[model samples]
Target: MSDNGTNTTDATAYDYSLYYSEDTSFFTPCNELDLKAFASVFLPALYSMVFVLGFLGNGLVVCVLVKHRNQTNLTDMCLFNLAVSDLLFALTMPFYAHYSAVSRWTFGEFMCRFISGCHHTGFFSSIFFMIVMTLDRYMVIMHTHKVARYRTLRAGLTLSAFVWLLSLCVSLPLMIFTEVSGDLYGLVCIYAPDNRAWKFYNVFVTNMLGLLLPLVVMVGCYSKIIPRLVNMKTAKKHRVVKLIVSIVVVFFIFWAPFNISIFLQFMQREGHLPNECKFYRDIKLAITVTETFAYTHCCLNPIIYAFVGQKFMKRALQMLSKWVPRIHFPPSRDLSEISFRRSSVTSKSSDITSTIMM
Candidate 1:
């Protein structure tokens, strides 16, 4: 037996020659063909649709948040940052779509780095904001007395700045390593590590810091929140807790498999298991789909937080009533001052009530 590229290996392989042999036919079970077919038809469609939807959805979120900036709270600030990250991520999806469509990257070196950098930046920022949101929820639910001191608008802005800075730091390696290289027909943007160990290191860092740790935090926060909600006497507050819990559940369900798949792929690449196994191939395809859906989780958050959490639709309608064509109101400084004072008083009262309740 000699090494060739045809024969499919079982779940273990130390050397290439273990699977491929000179006596074996050049084409066995059409493994590459199956993989190509799946990648060609499925990946392009999945990436394209998710890209379009995510772009539009996140764009709407940004617009709505901007429009209602006066109503911004700590939660809204987190949502705004999340929407920005998603929008940037969605912008990069076209390049991925092009690659999937043509089975290659035609973009040059700078774009390759930029796109990869943006991808990592968006991913890190998204996860960071999510973790912050979970902590925000925890403070509001479990540590309400402390939220007023730490969860202010200024604090949220500072936290968001830190998130962006952290994301930028994490993503710098992508800019350094990713480049467009291959044949004329099939350029790929990949991290050209000095050694295989470096590749595994990159995968492990991304999987652990970017995905797994945040997931654990989210689950832990929501677990405590849910039990408290169940015991709450206030039905309205319970509903809000349930809604937040649902968001966390949805995030976990969408992202958990994608992150796990990255770990598995790293294992396969490191020769921990044979890549030629049918199970590996099938799981790879599942991973592609799962990742596509997981990335779109960003777009869903704005809807959950804005329209659903804050009743943006109804509030928008109320705000629009003042703009009817024939409606006119005489200028009244006294009334305006009274309204402003009333709002300030109401807000202070609500804060006091919340503090006392806690």
Candidate 2:
């Protein structure tokens, strides 16, 4: 019925009449006991931490972007959208935390669908935005003159809108297929497609659009960007390049294991991987652990940006300095360091090789 992305249907085949019923007298409970204790204790706590950190981090990122919205480059515009996606993704963690804490869905059918849609939408947007950001960097650093006209605010916003529109199309199945099922033993919200074809379609599309395509495009973009970096002499811009590279690698590090496990599980379900109790249990546990780790990416982004982006740090400091009267520095630190970037953009607006966009 499926290939990847952890839909319950992708595993063991089930007879719907037994699990789905109008009778309230009898019900089927979610039988995910192998990792029950681990899930109940670990998932809620981990999700809670991610929620707090991601929400705060992405919130600050958005604030910084808005404060400098007028001054932001194309990459910053991409990052602004990325932060928004992370914040939205973080918003879904609490619902999942609750789902894990109690081992059930108490929020009703409507929310079951809503949360799933939001979760997948956030995933699609995050990776797609990263790909877009990478392409922007590649163009800005490698093909400056040719891509100059498309590096402006209106162009960036237009491209962003298209990515979201495509993301929406990819994520629409979640809202349509997700459902709250099982008995009062505890309701479970999951991908519950009415048919096997739909199940296969969902998994296939999700993997291709959500993971594989973005990864391929990003790898290609970096192939070009890295060589340009090697030849560059600018000390300050190296930090920006490093930051972007670190974010890409970290993001893949977090998400790859979970997605790989899902793919393996699909293979097993389709008789490709060895089907045994031990292997099945291992895959299930791997998914639980990797999924937890993957969620941390949302929380780690701002830390990476702050650590590597000097200009961003300077701006962040400027923002904080406005609020903290006791922490005083020379007022000249604000726009003087940033004005050079604006001036550079104007003269070399067509020549990306002349100056790197911060």
Candidate 3:
């Protein structure tokens, strides 16, 4: 004011500007309202859909296989057990949905442990069964002559028991680690420990044992199987191979990304990476959605199996025939017979019968 030299005595107090170098953490206020709305609406809907579909799908597969008593073969028994594990897992989804919708865990500590234990149990069981299935397929196709003796009902039952025991062992950590905790938002069921080590332990164990190893086995088995399938000239064999390939493809497509995302989340949580990154958050959300879809594959299999299983379409038609009014439908020719007729200029009756049988 003195330097400006107009009226130093009555100079007004200068209004100085205050500048803030924004802290990244303080940039975005925790939008509690948005989070609550998301939890109340979208989470519940997602969980409900996954739960209902997974339960029905897995249940139907188990019922159909068990009722027919057609799952005596080791491979078939393994598939049946896989369905059972998936159904059990599906059972817990409603509880999760309820918690998410309410934005709190009204269930007690015991239930929190139980639910978490069941989730791991199902997951490990599913992985074990899938691995067994892949191994069985490999043996059946590549070493059929030598491995035929091991495909008995007794062997199947023993293997299934071992898988169950292994799964139970894997789930033991859940019983020990899972707990219910209260925060400003609500009571959250979380894995609480003194240090972050257990979180890393859980993530590594699940990613390696539950996902990576099994995936490697599946891929290895299929790689060898594909060449054998290609060389087979018979239509029936080719169809069966194609069906199995489709199942493998679907499994990989639905699960690979989900598991990868889960691994990343684990890394983020352990301070190996920053969790506040927007990209990470988006990936986490995507993983949650994708995992839900992947879980639905457990239900999708029965539909696939019904279509591809031996004589399933015929049996389904027979069942339909009982409900519908009798109408004259044209007799369906065997696909093999049609193919033989088209390929061979001189079509012998014996050739037609052989092709039909094949």
Candidate 4:
């Protein structure tokens, strides 16, 4: 058992610390030299690449969205919030990259808590916004006239604020418990509460809020939407259906493995799985690989959620042309002409605007 009566050691309990020194007394110190060496090289390089791509992509989305803030609909607002979440998430990559490469937390206690808080806040916020967007699409498509008045700019803003608040609430425990303390190695930033219950809470929150809840919501919403789209005769409906499918599939593909790995570790702690050395090493490796895939989703969000939309791409090019006068972009199609008109749906549904419907 751990010092806190948990089966998890410092590094195993939470994934924040990438490497552990073998001198730990809380558990049998497993020599992880091979894993440490691999992470030192692998994590820094991949994290740097992700930071560059995710920052640029999400940054462009923010610029375009802010420029068109007045014209934004509920969907656009959700997309904007999503971009902000990804940017927040991306900003933490460099810190973690440095931590992994050097195998220590040199940034101090404040940053350790702050970065951990930001990382979880961004994660939950991003997922929550995606859920919000999904439900928004469902309401606009399925409920139509019933939700029309409530889908206004003010409502979107209110909902966005709520999501951020909830995300912060969920992340608060992790932030409070996270500290820069001396491990067997140098100082490491980790969730190191004395109570083992907090460890369970950490994993429970991650599994339930981050994965299970979102998965259920997406599945429920999309199941209703698919059949509705199938019955519709418009080509626009067909395209919207495809985008919806892509959103759901991509999310699970990138996130499911990571969540599953966390869950398995939780189960092992609960004595539901074998707690052997090989299992420990294997699970750690799985978490590392799967987490990398999950991180890349921030980079993909711009393409999946915004760039796929013709109107968004046009606006982006227009913005680009303005910022770089030397390079010319083709004149975009007339906004009035390109705006999608949903057939046979209520006028409120038609109000969804081409800003989001790809």
Candidate 5:
């Protein structure tokens, strides 16, 4: 009887060991997600919403800017290119939505590479344009006298092209590495770093080059602007400054979480972090949630532009005048009351223009 009892206890203990075994994903050659139905179901809806909003908002921006392409100023040029980047990025969301829903790259390998490259390309270009846009604002506010020669339409287009090229250079490596592979239960489309060293460098370089540098430039621009804003007596200047500040804050809010999580992931993978089961699970969850949050940043800019950019609001009203028969604003009203401040062609003259799109 005692022998039988001992055997039964041993069997129970073995079953417990099986139940509590470490998730071997931590030791695997590649990162794997033990995804549940929750991810498959929940993420599709969010991605869809982002796609819809992003498309509509960015489309409107393109339409408005292109219609007045001949008259577009430096800031208008920035807004237009920024919208282009967002629109391109948003186009790839449906593919990702399907990927999220199915947890597979059903579109095949070419698509796996193409779609991934496009999104990252758009990601880099958009942020680069944003950084340039902020720097343009800084130049206008602080060194208006010296900046006019370089803020021309030709200059802006050249800069935009340069940014796009830079984006392509940054994203090309991702295309080479992206592949579809089977992880125990299913197939995954992932960035297949060749080794641990490559993986670490990939995470380190992408985030550092793509995120950290731009963030510093944006922050520095806004920090300098803040003191000037406080000293300004005009309510209109305050409003413009406030809108710019809000834009900077929103950009940081959406992007910082995702990149910070990437840093944590690097640490954990490198054994700098404790390998607790719950911690790993939470980090994985955070990455999924935060990455989706980051995707929304592509579309969110137009909403902010619409609400806060008073001049842009005026132009929207003008556009609506055609569709809404009774709607009309006086021709004498400020067409662009609060433009990004700029100086005239002559360095000798400090004549500033108050033309921003409404």
Candidate 6:
């Protein structure tokens, strides 16, 4: 359990583990293998796929939102912002992919900081906007009368500004601490805290804000929404319930494992859990694998939230058709029917569903 002879060149291969404690320094080198060898091959390919899909899917969402900016409502505004956040997140993947593939930080110190900042900012902002969307849905369904005045275009802009500012603030620690430095793995970009406390702080912040808080809010909001949807006899109610369930289920499925893995690692580093070498290696591998799954959640955002919407798909296809003249797409039967309303209190439950989804 000494750093003198142990080869930790492969430790902490990506930014995901930048906050992880250097426990390799204490790990006994008995029969040690290159745990990160799998990462060098597996992660680059997965990251590349995530980057391409996230960029294209989110790019299309952005294009559609912009094309109809004048008609955007609170829901549309949230979707637009979410897509932008994912786009920002997707842009950082290639740099990380290169770092993973080669185990070097060739992007220099500034990019090291910039990309780290951008990555966390995107992550925080995406989750924050989803929280906003959930609340928006709650208000529209359960407190329709009161939400009208507050769900305006002006209100959405203000909320978006606040969320962006907050996300930047939350990510500042990683931004300020991240640097490119020479390590056993050669030059690497990492969030190198000066003390173990700072490392622990990073993990605590990510776990609380990135997963725990959002999960609570989502569960609370959807609990009210599901019963409300169930009480209604309209056919559209089923679709609304289905979409709500999908959102919550997908978010948990994609992110929970990753968060749990890192939290366990943090606990082990704190000596609260057994520190056996086999357990340590397993947890590290789990972090790498689960982090890859978590990163791909951004790619699924557009699909679950936007593309599945009948009206949104129609509009996106119409936009695509115009861009590619050879490909014909059926125009929306009645664009006016899909227009956003200033209030939904007096509207039917089905109308509320369409307004939120469309």
- For 1-358, candidate 2 gives per-residue lDDT tens digits of 1223223443211111112222211113334454676777888899899999999888888998899888877778878888888888899989988877777678887877777777778878977887787677777777766887867888888988998888778788756877766643355666666777876866576567656787788778877777766565544445546655776688678877877877776666667776566676676678778777878987886776442454677777678798777898554345354446655544343234322233
Pairs that collide, model 3: none
After TM-score superposition, what is the CA distance of residue 249 in candidate 5 from its true location, in Å? 1.7
Predicted candidate 6: what Cα RMSD to the true structure? Answer: 3.8
| lDDT value, residue 103 of candidate 6 | 66
- Score residue 121 of candidate 1 by CA lDDT: 86
Cα lDDT tens digits, model 3, 1-358, are 0122111110000000000001123123323354355546866687788788888777766665675565356656877798888887788888877876776678888888888778778877987888888787777666757887877998989999999999998777655666665544556566544455655666666678866788789789878866765565545556656666776778778777767776765555445775465744454456546666666766676665553554434444444455554854333445455655554423332222221122
Model 1 steric clash pairs: none
For each candidate, what is the lDDT? Answer: 0.63, 0.68, 0.61, 0.79, 0.66, 0.80
Candidate 4's TM-score reads: 0.90
Pitting candidate 1 against candidate 2, the one with the higher lDDT is 2
Give the candidate number with the greatest lDDT. Answer: 6
For candidate 2, the TM-score is 0.82
Q: Over the full model, what C-alpha lDDT does candidate 1 score relative to the true structure?
A: 0.63
Model 6: worst 10 consecutive residues (lDDT sum): 5-14
TM-score against truth, every candidate:
0.77, 0.82, 0.77, 0.90, 0.82, 0.90
lDDT of 5: 0.66
Candidate 1, residues 259-341, lDDT tens digits: the string is 77767765655567664657555655666666777777766766666556324544433444565546543332332344354
Superposed model 5: Cα runs more than 4 Å off? 1-35, 321-332, 336-358
Model 3 scores a C-alpha lDDT of 0.61
Displacement of the residue 357 alpha carbon in candidate 3, Å: 16
Please report the TM-score between candidate 3 and the true structure. 0.77
lDDT of 4 by residue, 1-358 (tens): 1233221333433335846532233224466878888888888888888899999999999999999988888888899999999999999999999998998789988998899999989989999998898888788778877988998888988999999999999989888888776655677787766687887888888888888888899999889988877775544666777887888889889989988987886676567887577786787788777888889999999999999887888999999998999999888776565335434453333344232373
